[model samples]
Target: MPMLDAIKRHLWSIALFGIASNVLVLAPTIYLLQVYDRVLPSRSLETLSMLMMFMGIALSMMLAVDLVRHRLLSDLGRQLADRLDRLALAARIDTHARRLSRPELATAQDVAALRAFLSGSGVTAFLDMPWLVVYLGLMFLFHWSLGLIAIVSALLLVGLTLLNDRLTENSVRAYTTRQRETDQMAAQISRNAEIVTVLGMNAAMIDAWSARRCVDLDAQVKAGETSSLNRSIGKALRQVIQAVMMGAGAWLVINQFATGGVMLATTILLGKALAPVEQMLGSWKQFTEVRQAWTRLDALYRSSPERRAVELPRPTGRLTVEALAFSSYSATGPRGRMLLKGIQFVLNPGQLLVIVGASASGKSTLLRLLAGLWEPQAGTVRLDGADIAQWPREALGRFLGYVPQDVELFAGTVAANIARDPNPAAADTGAIVRAAQRAYVHETILGLPNGYETEIGESGETLSGGQRQAIALARALYGDPRLVLLDEPNANLDADGERLLNSALLQLKRDCVTVVVVTHRQSVLSIADRVMLMRNGQVDCFGTREQVEAWVKSRARPAAAPQSGEQRREAAAS
Candidate 1:
């Protein structure tokens, strides 16, 4: 209902268009019925020809109007959807600090729902209301009692529609769940493709996932079928009721004829009275479905938590986290469980701080807090003298360049990806080339068929591991931020690739940019000015390379000796 109100507020022009279309369509239907007595009574070739010609003209006009309406509605729908997408994206961008679940994926569905809401429910409401009015008015003009019969049937059909709505509510929920599972299955199958091929278990693995997909799809199909069956049954019942009404009207006219009072044209009017009632019953289901879909889509837009904007606190250089703590509650666990506790750190300009930790040690979460991507549940994060909590997201971004472990690339040329936001001043080609060369991705890109102009394909699928990392670093460097937060920058790099990353970090430090790198690689110990080992959600130790290395090696496992020929062969087979 809120969506309907919003649409009605903006669609005054569309309403006028609808009104014109309704008048054009109804004029012919009404004129023909009113003049039926004169036209039908003649039963001559001349009259028949004239009637056929008029009908043909009316039909052509209706077809032309329908085509025009379709074209206009489609264009309007696309524009409306695009506008809503921009609004949604703006809302997301404004709340950039808040962590979002499946953020990018939600945009597709949200935009699609908006388009369907506009074209189907929006235009239909405007166009159909007038048709309903004219249709009922013609029924009343035919005969008083027959008009009442049509109205009663319409009311009953409306009741059936409401009942069907209640019955189909569960189906919508099931459809959404099934769709999510289907998406997950698709992602998993794609990720496990190489594993399945090497193990020669492709058929078995595929069958397992395919069976799950089929089960989910079957549930969706069953829900659809049930909803369809309910609608079909409701329509059939309405038709039967209309048929009985028509039969009674015919009987009444015959009885009047026996009493020498009935007219042929009057009896014909009874059929006309029932026609619109049948159509109203038929369109009722679509109207209800569309209305429900619109309401569901609108509820999200209205109640979205990201719409709020808070005052931003201004921050200078030297980012700091003082006794910062954050907690994440799992759906399967008790609430209020802490993920990070009393985490304190600082990285000033011209400094390099290395955070070393095992996988899932809440290391990345600490980086996010430092980057101001998230607020701590307790304690404070400060930049210079200002609280990070108050800093504007864009202002904070200007100072920090974060590269996550899993780098993402858009489907575009390497040059476009490197210079993500093209500036009027332009990224100096020499600088870009030097950065690429430092990341060790320069020669790899040049080897591609089109060099820097080559399309990376979806998510940089065409690029190798080292190439992807270098591209991501180049993107981050393009901004020339004062602080760089590298989350496992050497994750996908070989020994030579790691050397390139070290060279780039050294260059950044020389430029007076603060660098914070998270890694578990012992090889990176030589490059750090101060190495901090993070464990159990807090800083375990911070000191010189030898001091941290001694502690790390004390707790670390020794390297395994080389295996014999048979052992090596067995390892290979395994």
Candidate 2:
């Protein structure tokens, strides 16, 4: 509805153009009638000349109407595409964040399909189908038999269209599903190409990918064959009907029921009447695709409805979470157990808190909730005593900085990534440099091929793990955010990178910015003002750094003195 809302204003104008077009369409039939009935008997050159001029003028006007109508539809398609671009992207993000079943599987390609459908001949043909009545009415004026023949022909074609749908509907659905699967597989291979080659999975993956592609191709072939066969039959059927009408017309002429010119004109009228039906049959496949795309787009827009946010002043990083609860969605529905429950905590400005937990102990989940990425089933996450959701989504980056466990960068210059610029050309160069310096990655960046202007490949695949994490740290610290949420910031960092990260955390405290870190490294605990040890989604201990350390020692957990990040993670999980 949102996308169609963009183009609703043009619909009436299109309808007016359609009326003009249909009226002008009578020129050819009337021309033939005049030449045969009036000019041939009178043998008048002047009359013929005037008729020819009139015919040309009528056709010219029709062409002009068609051109304007085409431009209107084209503009509508572009408007729909522009409106859907933002909605699809936001829906994608929300869908992934909510961890819900993606039955709709909406994507940008759906927008392209909708645009193409609106601009393509299929829509014009569809619009023309309704005007078949105009041709039917003209044929009836010529003779009752001619109108009867036209009605039967139209009925047959409509029946074929329905039959086409029934025979190929399943095949079309299969083709759509397989096509999405194939695309997803290709993306997976591209993303994991490094590991696939390193592990000698090229041959196996190629066979698997080929097999999936073949399934898609087979479904496509089945649907296409059915559609093409129906189209061929429909075409043949139209020819037969035209021949029958012609025979009837000649018989009527012989019986003095119609003039020779009238007989010829009935043939032309019948063909004109059937044109839209034939076209609709030919474009049945496209119609199906467009219908599916529209359905998916509609569902996506509904899932993520637009909301108005009430403006509030900048938060001072007073974070609070009381009696929070969250659960994962299983295939059937929400899981029976909560992932995070009874999560109660408060961190004021200038305070630094570190959270340590096992793989599934909900540390990362809690961080996501605190960052307002995920909503809790119960209780609320508040900043400055107001609900986090009160601030508009566009203003989130200014309120908090988040560094997830997986550090993947977009494809752009280093400075653009640091500044988080949606448009790289207008990035804040000075702020970018300061953030990079604060994260202690400026020196490393300078050593790159183009310094801050280097083009990092997709997901920063060109960089090493430690270098990627270092740049991610800079990105998280880019703007003057009031709070920072970090999940395993030092997981992939080297010794120098870890030292720089510690310095950055210390700097945040000096600036009175509340910071919460989830890590498996002992180095962070040394600088932590407070610590929380999570066990089975519950806070097992919460106190000063020494208190949590003593609790870990009493439990005989190896978390107090971690030798390696991986070992610490394994120990905490155990």
Candidate 3:
């Protein structure tokens, strides 16, 4: 349905071209009739020459019209792809944020499939299908018997097409699903090649991948077998139909109901009428694929939220979280595990808040909420007295910087990675240099073979873990964002990296930027003006450094050793 909506404007042009092309097709049959019935009996050179000229002119016009038609379809395909690409990408991002099943790859592949079908011969066959009726009507005028044969042949081919669709539908759907899963698995394995190799787990990974591939392969083979069978049957049926049309025409001529030229022309017309059907049958697989692609893409577009129509002002550095809660679900039921519960906190401009907690204590979840990467189930994260969700995503991104525990860098030059630039050539060189300098990795980058131009392998594999973390930190610091959230920012940093990180934080504090750091390291805690201790999805303690430290000590102190009887008596006397 969406596909039709996209190309409706161009449909009229395609239809006109089909009409002109089919009309010109009549020139050949007419020429054959004239040659057999009139020219031969009259022996008129003028008539033959004139007919030849007309035939040539008609065919040349047909060629030109058909060419234009194909070009229009190709343009339509381009238009569809351009319109859907951004929408599809945005939908994928939204789905990921919601922690839903990812269908990005499948969506992209579906768009490509539809585009290919639109620009291929399959579309041309579809456009010409309407001409079958015109051809059949002309055949009926030749003789009743010939017309009857043509009608029956068309009906049989149509029946075969419907049968093929019925037989292959389920298999095709299964094959497509399995193929997407296999592709995702292969990609995961490729990205983790180093780990698999070092752990000697290649065999195991391959076996796992092969299991999925085998299921995909089985579905493909079954679908292919059925499709091939239909193709074979369709081909045999066409040949038989052509033979019967010829034999029937001969019979009509023997009965003096039709002339030899009429017989020949009727047979040719019958073939022309069946051509579209045969072509469609041959390309049924592609047709089915396109249909499936359209359905999926339509659903994706429908599910995505519309973009913000109005812009909001930029946010200041004050950050607040009120009663934030989050949970996830599964098929059986809700996971019944709350990652964050009743989270309430506030940090003013130019202040630092450090959150300390053991693993699975909801520390990272709070940071993610503050960054607006995940939405709260029952509360709001506000910046400068306005809900973060109220601001446009792009506008919010300008003032928000976040670094997760796991750092990933794109495949590009060091400068591009540091700048977070989607287009490297257009990136701000000065901004990149400043960020790199602030992170204290500028000199290290210069020491490399190509200063800022060195290419980092995928996910920055070419660099050490510390180098990646430093660059990622520099990326977060880019533009001097108003609010910065870091999860274990010093996790991989060595002594020098840690020193640079501290310097950066102090500078941010001086610049009046709000910062939230989640760490277990005491060195990081020492700089915090305020600290919160998280345990079991709730804040256990929240106060200034001294107050929180005192509480932590009180909690950590073991109960005094059981007093001996003499010690207890001395204490009571005192």
Candidate 4:
């Protein structure tokens, strides 16, 4: 609706063009009348030649106006697409961050569909629909009975169109929902193709995928069948109307209320009046699809959160977390169990803090909160004395680097992956190589056939898991980020990879970059200035490395000591 106001000028121009084109549509009927009533009776070649010249000029003007109308619509559609594409993508990304299910935000495909409808024949039909009255009035000029019949036929076709819409709306909606779910499932299967193939899950996966496909297909078939039936009936009725109009015209002419030329011209005018309605009936499905797409896009745009208008300066490495808490939605709905509660920590610039915890101990949740991937329900995360939400996202991203537990690379060249730049040409080659060197992946990259220019398959499928993690580490270290968060960075690393990771962390520390790493391996703890141990979503210990290690040893001593005299006697016998 607001979008309509934006393109009002374009719509007005199209309306003017429609009026001119429909007026010229009367040229053929006029030509027939002149030929039958004037030229033949008088045997005047001059009159025929003059009429032909005027008709030619009128039709040419009509053609020129129609072309301009189409061009305007196309330009309008392009402008709309350009404006909506970025907003749609942003909304989709925001929805993902909020952990919301909004399949309509998955892509800008809906924008494209709306654009196509705007520029295609569907719009032209809509613009011409209003001119149907003009043709009907022309029919009335010839006789009253013909006008009555034309009005009745038009109403019948309009009723049929309304019926079609009512019958197919629900099925179309269901089909759209099912199709999006199936597409998502298919993408998931493709991403995990290696696991499926190695585990011999091809049959089970295929069966599951096919089940969704079948449901989607069933909905589509139901909608299609209803639309097709209506279209066929509309076509048959349109033919009948044309024939009946001609017969009625002949009756009027025979009764001396009209001329033969009047009868013929009126019948042709009737068809012209109903042509747009017939075309709309046949294109009801496309019209419905475009309407749904527009509705979804509008809803998405309206629901998207307003972004910060003011940009702030980049942050320094000093980090703070105060009573942070967060929860996620469960399968049932909102208000699920909490994942992190009262999480408190602080790390100054140039500090190296290592977090050690068992599996499912809230380590990853803490890292995500620190990295701003998930917002805390309570408390504030601050950097450089400013709340994380206060700083502009782009500025914050430049100062922060995060390597998640599951390392995956996008489809691009090795250099591009390391740079994390969408535009490869704009990527800084020097910085990329420096980051790779720091991550100790430079030599391994050079050993490849094309080195930095080598193409990495989707998610780096062509390379080993260690190779992917190394490049991802390089990405995190790119541009000498002021703050780095690594979650289990050495999960897939070999001995050499582990050494490179530690060396990278050491170099980062020397550069005054604050770092937080989550690891179970004690080897990585050698570089830690402080240690935080977590248990059951709470911090068990937080202090200097020496203090935490001594506590750990003391706790182990009790469990290692003899628990009973029987155990002591067995040991003495041995």
Q: Rank the candidates by TM-score, best first.
A: 2, 3, 4, 1
TM-score of 1: 0.75
Off by over 4 Å in 2: 1-6, 302-305, 330-333, 554-574
Every candidate's lDDT: 0.66, 0.86, 0.84, 0.85
Worst 10 residues of 1 by lDDT: 257-266
Best by lDDT: 2
Provide the TM-score for each candidate, comma-separated. 0.75, 0.94, 0.93, 0.91
Q: TM-score of predicted model 3?
A: 0.93
RMSD of 2: 6.9
lDDT by residue (380-445, candidate 2, tens digit) is 999999888777777877768888887879998788888888575786788888888878889999
Q: What lDDT does model 3 reach?
A: 0.84
The residue-by-residue lDDT of candidate 1 on 106-173, one tens digit each, is 34455675566556544454355445545556656656665676667666655765666666556655
Q: How many clashing pairs in candidate 4?
A: 0
3 versus 4: better TM-score goes to: 3
| Number of the candidate with higher TM-score, 1 or 3 | 3
User: For model 2, what is the error of residue 172's alpha carbon versus the real structure, in angstroms, after optimal superposition?
Assistant: 0.8
* Model 3 superposed RMSD (Cα): 3.0
